[model samples]
Target: MTARDLGLPSRVPAPGLPERVTIWEVGPRDGLQNEDAVVPVEVKLEFLDRLADAGLTTVEATSFVHPKWVPQLADAEELLAGLTPRDGVRYPVLVPNERGLDRALAAGVRHIAIFASATETFANRNLNRTLDSQMAMFEPVVSRAVAEGLDVRGYVSMCWGDPWEGAVEPGAVVSVGRRLLDMGCSQLSLGDTIGVATAGHVAALVNAFTDAGTPVSALAVHFHDTYGQALANTVEALRHGVTTVDSSAGGLGGCPYAESATGNLATEDLVWCLDGLGVDTGVDLDKLADTSAWMATKLGRPSPSRVVRALRG
Candidate 1:
């Protein structure tokens, strides 16, 4: 059955709900990239251990971006090399180019995520290339990775709307998604980069994407909580059969290109919402809250996650 068949109600029978939803925890990488004070590699390893213990099966451990762009994650190789990966858990990392891909492969990582923005402006600003150039660069990476038996996940930023380019056309997002799938990406994550998307917009865009032969099973939604609409948009996507979600612990990370944009949707918050709706994420909410609070303390800031704050209260 599709997500539409389930409908949106305030309550659902615990036994009558969908079997499960896939949650990709992105705390270790996206959560710490923008911090001014460098987080030690050991601290990063501890954080990852807590995430695994919290019942997360997929965690983005680090990024392979150049140190000049994001110095905080310069220890990507060291970090991934040290983690004692759990049996059921999958550890993935972000790779920006061929060199980054090589680094991850050397560390024996099986999952890798590549990024490109739907808007030309964001692509140029973040990736130093136009949309066409970014796609061209991804071709060889995707091809080689597939040959190596690695799973490739594609991220299309600003899928909902862009700060500079204004409301992005649905067609533009779908076109990029198609290209990524054609390049052999096993999954496509639609990123609401600036958190400007609404529930209606999410449904419309998801419907369009699924209708265009971009298999719904291969789609995941990634939203920022900048406008307090991340959860709502996620619900809309779930209703349309988009089961995979990309969220960060403690609501960490924001797009540098999208000025003043806040954190990605908090994993703690998403877990709470899903648990209440009878959706099983295999995540321990209390443990997730504890980890989020610990990271917030390390950063010397309050958590951006409302659920974490409420639970602590």
Candidate 2:
């Protein structure tokens, strides 16, 4: 039987959910970066094409980080060069520093993302700097990108909980988020890097950001499904006025730096929830599920997305 046959509600019973939500698909970069085997550039390109065809408007194409760090996505330049840019589709690449920005700029990228951690331990481990220093490092990159008319997104990792530090205070996330916004990022994506957040935790963090004078509209949520709370947390964020969400196709991401973190909230799963709520995401659920299932073949594993698995069954 199909999902529709299951008699799911066409719209959510709860009020206050946005009529439309923007989903930023991060499978191409974050999803593939931690893979044990190298995915050929051609396969990566095809995966991107399928994702775009599945109706994702904002697809993070690749990261311009050092090849040594993320060898799976070493072909960022080639991937960007080979893409057939679609009208109304935005492709953003991750840029670690001015050097990565230079590479992205050279590759003709128009949108880039810079990431910082809310906790000191994650900051030191991931960026090899303190929280303050990491913010300082991204300042120049954000400034240069804005000056060049490139869309910039800032990611604050470990927004809810940290592996070493445990139970992160929302205030610390707010401070880093405010700095990133002040640095000229068009949007800030709050990440539950270890997927330890519950719905209540999600609500508190969103409220904290708004209480600190940061517009909820400028914020996005990026959650991992480790504790099985990603969808619940996403619903809480949406109810709290956050309209942008970051997800991966086939649930294909895990933070390499934070080894305990699991796969990201799947694009298919998110789309299914939104579709049932009568929320518009401009994404075709069946197409996305099929695309992910196809990618599973390339990755030599079954897709982790429940929606994809159900559709395939």
lDDT of 1: 0.88
lDDT of 1 by residue, 101-183 (tens): 88888989999999988989998988889999999999988999999999999999999888888999899999999999999
Error of 2 at 4 (Å): 8.7
Report lDDT (Cα) of residue 247, candidate 1: 96
Per-model TM-score, in order, reads 0.94, 0.97
Pick the TM-score winner. Answer: 2
Residue 5 shift from truth in candidate 2, angstroms? 6.4
Please give the lDDT score for candidate 2.
0.92
- In candidate 1, stretches whose alpha carbon ends up further than 4 angstroms from where it belongs are 1-11, 14-17
lDDT accuracy of residue 62 in candidate 1: 91
Candidate 1's displacement at residue 227, Å, is 1.1
TM-score of 1: 0.94
Q: How far out, in Å, is residue 237 in model 1?
A: 0.4
Q: Which candidate's lDDT is highest?
A: 2
All models: lDDT?
Answer: 0.88, 0.92
